[model samples]
Target chain A: MSDTKPLVDVRDLKEYFPIHTGWGRTLPLKAVDGVSFTIKPGETLGLVGESGCGKTTVGRTLLHLYKPTGGEFYFDGELVTEKNMPSLRKQMQMVFQDPYSSLNPRMTVEDIIGEPLDVHHLYSGRAERREKILSLMETVGLNAEHATRYAHEFSGGQRQRIGIARALAVNPRFIVCDEPVSALDVSIQAQVVNMFEDLREKLGVAYLFIAHDLLIVHHISDRIAVMYLGRIVEIADANELNNNPIHPYSISLLSAVPIPDPRIARSKQRIIPEGEIPSPLHKPSGCAFRTRCPYATERCAAECPELTERSDGHLVACFNK
Target chain B: MSDTTPKKAPFSMQIDPALFEPATAEEKKQQEVMSESTTFLKDSMKKLMRNPLAVFSIVVLAFILIVIIVAPLVVPYGYSEILKYNGMKDKTAMNLAPFQYSANEQKYMAENGVTLFPHIFGTDELSRDYFIRVVYGTRVSLAVGFFASLIVLVIGVLYGSISGYCGGRVDLIMMRIVDVIYSLPDMLVIILLSVVLKELLDGSKGIIARLGTNMVSIFIVFGMLYWVGMARLVRGQILSVKENEYVLAAKSIGTSSPRIIRRHILPNCLSVIIITTALQIPSAIFTESFLSFIGLGVAAPMPSLGSLANAARQGMQSYPYKLMFPALMICLIVLALNLLGDGLRDALDPKLRK
Candidate 1:
């Protein structure tokens, strides 16, 4: 995978929100603090974390929806900046988590999908625009008859499909699938996930799939990165991380994934952590998981751990691992 | 197992591959039980049609519009022209009763072999036909209401969309300016502007001279002060609508800021804008009438409903019907507009829809 250049390379991305702490003072809530990852062409990199761990923020910042406080984003070896964001946006797109809110309620399905085409002037004329929209809708498994209908008329799964069609309108090289199936039914999630996989195979598009569903992430990802608090603690191949997690947080997380067989489920050792996840507003010093870690040492609190290669293609950030 | 006795076949766990085949076009078409497609506007219009009160209001407004338009053509009397017979001022026509002809008009008709039009709502103190004046008054008031609201709509939508979409420091400063405008006394501004504009536009002819300084000042005041309400409303709406994931989706797709507001945010805010504009018309009409009542509306000889009512105030005891005519017209217009506005609010507001 390293032979081909990475389609998206994010380095030391930091996004801080200044929240008013009252009394004429403010504090920087470190939502995403120096998180970094890279996606090779046509690869799916799954980002898993608890709620409010900046999973969505990472996706948004990469797309320049919310300007990153500090970071360097290289897309196809070209540095993405404010000056070039409009042009670079053509190569990247995003599928939001919520199906209902992600589509403009006022717009018809045809208009929704054609918006990107209109913005980029991608089509030759009206007929070509219509043809492009219909083809895109068909690609996402939407009916041609459903084009003129408003967003409110569609079901949740169909709405998500329309959103997907809209994302695919520009033929983007990379997409940020931010919990795309999180707001869907279990039955529908499978269909959408399968469609995503099919599109990746057919179109050769890369994805930054952010979701907390470990099973879904494991099922679709080529590589998986485990995040704790605002930092990534472990990253490795999906099967390798699932079978042999190095970080304690990832260990606890994988242990929580339910097994189908009752025999294994009854015999499995559940490593429930000792404390609640610390608030990002006042993150703990040093290793964020140390307070909940079983093997917390004095050095763990004294210094923050850096991601180190434990084996081929496996990275862990911990002192006593 | 091979004996003649009924041998049970071994159970097979394998499923048929044919059942797993993709659905045919015929079957897929049957599965797609979708309703007829309708745009947002057409859907809203359907909902609006179902409302009987709104329908009735619409009919009444339509009837009133037709009456105002047609009455001028049929009445055969200019709004400001005094009643004259055989090219002479008919002094006896002053304060005549409804449908009555003056002694000179009767004599002149008898002599010239031509019958004259009677005063439909009686002649005013100035001997002008009151019905034509009333019709012209309705025209002036409706024009003011519509133009003023249009001015408010353009300025408010532009200002508010920019302020809300830009947000942060720009929004803060822009909103503070809106706050300052909101705090200013609207009535005082109208009076001051009218005083100044009357002098400045004194000799101007054509439409300006016809609208007069007072009407122009009222429109200016509406553009300046009245738009704050709409601006604040649109700002509040955009502030919330901008946070929706669709807006972020548009941004991620490289949609320009103006296009995002125009195609996405503004369309979502349409209900509020339509409702506010509908409601604004009545208020503007009322304000213009009130200003006219105080001798600050359209210039002299240009009859407005308020000025007509003011003229009728003196003859209240003797000719009570004079007051009734203009008063009833004003009431009907304002009430019809108010009802229409309410109906629009209920129809256009998606939150209020079933």
Candidate 2:
């Protein structure tokens, strides 16, 4: 997998939002600061992080939905910029988190899915457009008879399917799934996750799946990168990270995943981190997790650590782990 | 007893071929439980139909519109023409009661073996047919109302959408301009424009000559001042609607900014726009009548509802019906429009849906 060129490569991305503070003052809120990673062709890179840790911001900035403060993004070894973003949009799409708000209420299912095709002028005629829309709906497991219905008439799971069909209209090669299943029921979540996996296999589409669910990420991702305070704290193979988490934050996060079996869950020890996650506006100096880390030291506070290879394919950002 | 016998052994493991067959087209159609497809406008119209008040208002408006169009064709007397008998001025026809005729008109009709059309609302102080004058007044008021609201709708939607979609500095500056416009006294603007345009449009032909300077200035004031309210409303709606996830979805698909505003944002703001435009009609009509009442409306010899009412005020003591005719017409039209606007608000608002 590593032998093939990376489909999406980022070399330090930054996004800062200027917030007004009255009296003609403006403060910069660093939403995503110097985050970097790469997704190989046909591989799923799961980005796991707590709320407000800039997981969604990274996905948005990569797609140019939000302009990057500073970064370089390469797709298929070609540099991406505002000039070529429109063409690149056809190759990259996004499935938003909320199903209800993502689909336009005023639009029918066919129009919603056919919108991307309309914008890009992908189809030849009305017949071809209808054919493309119905086939896309079928691919996302929606009934062809449901084409004319509004978004509000469908259930949550079905609405998400419509949203997915819309994202897949252009047959994108790389998709950013921003917590796609987080707003769904557990039963529906499994169905959606399985559909995503099946789509990846059939279409050979790479995905940057951002989710806070560790178990689901471990189940579907080839590589997982854990983020804390707008930075990637760890990156490793899914199983390697699950079995041997090196960063103090990653260890605590993995331990927090609920074990299904009561007998084994009682026997397992959960590592609870102390204090609260620091605010992105006023993040702690040096290491963001040092305030909550049990292995904090003078060196950890004096200098921030960069992600360095600790094992065969495991990377951790910590002085001692 | 024979039918009770087991068909093919209870709970047979063999699969039934019939069960695995694909659904036929008829069965597939039956599986779809949704009702017939409806567009946003059709859906809103359906809801509007369910409201009795809205339907009543629509009927009333339609009737008034038809009457205004047809009355002039049938009425024998022109709105501004003075009554004459045998090609000479008939002074006795002045201030005749509704359906009443002067002795001179009766004698002329009797002698000529021809019956003249009865004065439906009687002759006014100037001996013009009151019924025809009322009809013409309605026509002028309705036309002014429609054209003014249209002006407001076009200018307001454009300004508001641009101000809203472009946030921060652009929005701030544009909204400040709206605030300035909002603070200007509309009555004073109309009075000033009427005086100024009256001089500029003197002896001008075409639409200016037909509508008169006062009516033209009233429309100008409506275009300039009335739109600020609509602009503010549209701006507030767009501020909230542009934040929806669907708008972001549109941007991600590379839709142009104008397309986003037209297709995505504006449709969501339609309820507000429709309600405001409906309500705006009555106010525009009222403003025209008010200006005319104060002698700042359509010029003399051309009748408007307000001017008609103003002319009737002199005979209010002896001929109260003169004032009543135009006044009643204004009241009915404004009331119907107000009810329709309320009904539209109720019907179009999604939050009010059951």
Candidate 3:
């Protein structure tokens, strides 16, 4: 991964949705505020956070699925702008969280998977298009016979595989996989994860894998970025971020992950942090996480810390860290 | 159910090879492929075909279609042609009963040694062939109903899609415009416009003159008054359909807004569109009949059912069946159309299907 430019580089991304309060007036819900990250080719960056922390929003914004209110993104060294989105989309794809709503119920599997090819005018003739669709089904571990079926005909895992096949249809270099496995059964989760790993090995595709499951994220990601209240508080190599978390929120979050061995897990101290996440509409001044942080000081209340690297490229946002 | 024998390999596989084998050919042959794929349209069509009432309605409508098309060709009398016998006028043929001939008609037939066809439904007050006039009236009324509804459909689909898809200030303004249209007294506006268009388009050479002053005015009224309901329905359908994630998926894939609306949004809203448009046809027909009954329908000499009914009302004390015949024709048409519309509504949306 050295000496090569990252395939996806996001700098100071902000996505705020306006809510109508009354009359003509409205207030902004700062869903993703000043977030930044990078993913090298063939790398997986796990994004983990509690629900409503804007993890899904980050994934969507990175792919321009939701237009960024303020930010600059570079895909393969080319700047991302609205004018170039049609071509840029060929390189970037997304696997949505809900297997149910993501696929159009009316369309056959072939049409759903072949949509990108149709939009791009990739195939010259009908025969070639059919062959490509069948091959894509084969690549995703779906039978060619299932190509003529619809989304409702499939189980949850099968539907996710269809969505994956659609994402890979364009032969994209990067994908925003937003909790692709969270909706499936635990028995099906490992099978899908192994497929992702194998596909990554075979195709050299990079992923921004967003989830609330820390164990799954730890198992798959080369690096991990933990989000809190629409901002990334810490990011480091997966093992380092899990074992030696520098920020208070990260330590607390990691404390919740139950170790598989019951003898050691029961003995582990769980931080059961107090208080609810403050509403993003009225975010706390200084550090957004300080209201929930145990080590928050007077100075911590006075200023927000920039995400600076402490050592060995482990970036944390707490001043005490 | 025989399984294929495993292929012989010199090297052992990492996992069992039998796991990948096609176990039984019965898996393929035990069931036939589904003959027809399930969809809102095909499923609804199946349901519609199975409904005896809908099928009967369609048959009645088709019979009307064929009769109107072929009746004038076979009938001997022009709708307005005054009958004559032996170089003299036969004024005694007024208000004759169905399948009856006057003494003058009989004398002409015997003198010529040729059979004069009896009036199939009888003559009117003008001694004109009532059967031929009724057929022509059916043609005109049916045409007016269908075209007016088409006008409503085109305008409504465009207005509703634009208002629903845009959804902010534009939607607010467009919906208010629809509301304004809805609240306006439609009959009063239609009457006033018909009076005005009757003056401007009577002899001025244009498409409206070809349709005559009354029919053109009726069309214009329909264009103005009928689209709001369809627009409101399409807007509601689109509002709900737009929330589905496939629309978002289409957007993320760089599909243009128009393409997304046409492909993703409209197809989902098709159930509503079909039901509304189907029902609108009969509404337009009923409105036309109401207008014609009030003496504002098709002009003189060009018969319409409502006008015929209006004409028959004066002779109702003596020739009551004259009123009954045209009135019965109107009822049959409206009823058939309404039943077909109901069937369409049931067939197009499976959510409402029993």
Put down candidate 3 lDDT per residue, A34-126, tens digits, no spaces. 999999999999999999999999988877777899989999899999888889888899998888888887677898899888888889999
* Alpha carbon deviation, residue A54, candidate 3 (Å): 1.6
Off by over 4 Å in 1: B1-31, B38-50, B85-92, B103-115, B205-207, B342-354
Which pairs clash in the backbone of model 1?
A: none
Model 2 scores what on Cα lDDT?
0.89
Model-by-model lDDT, in order?
A: 0.88, 0.89, 0.85
Docking class of 1: medium
Instruction: Say which prediction, candidate 1 or candidate 3, comes out ahead on TM-score.
Output: 1
TM-score of chain B of each: 0.83, 0.85, 0.84
Which digits, one per residue and each the tens of the lDDT, describe model 1 over residues B22-60?
889999999777678766677788888888877887898
Indicate the worst ten consecutive residues by lDDT in candidate 1 chain B: B1-10
Top candidate on DockQ is 1
Backbone clashes, each candidate:
0, 0, 1
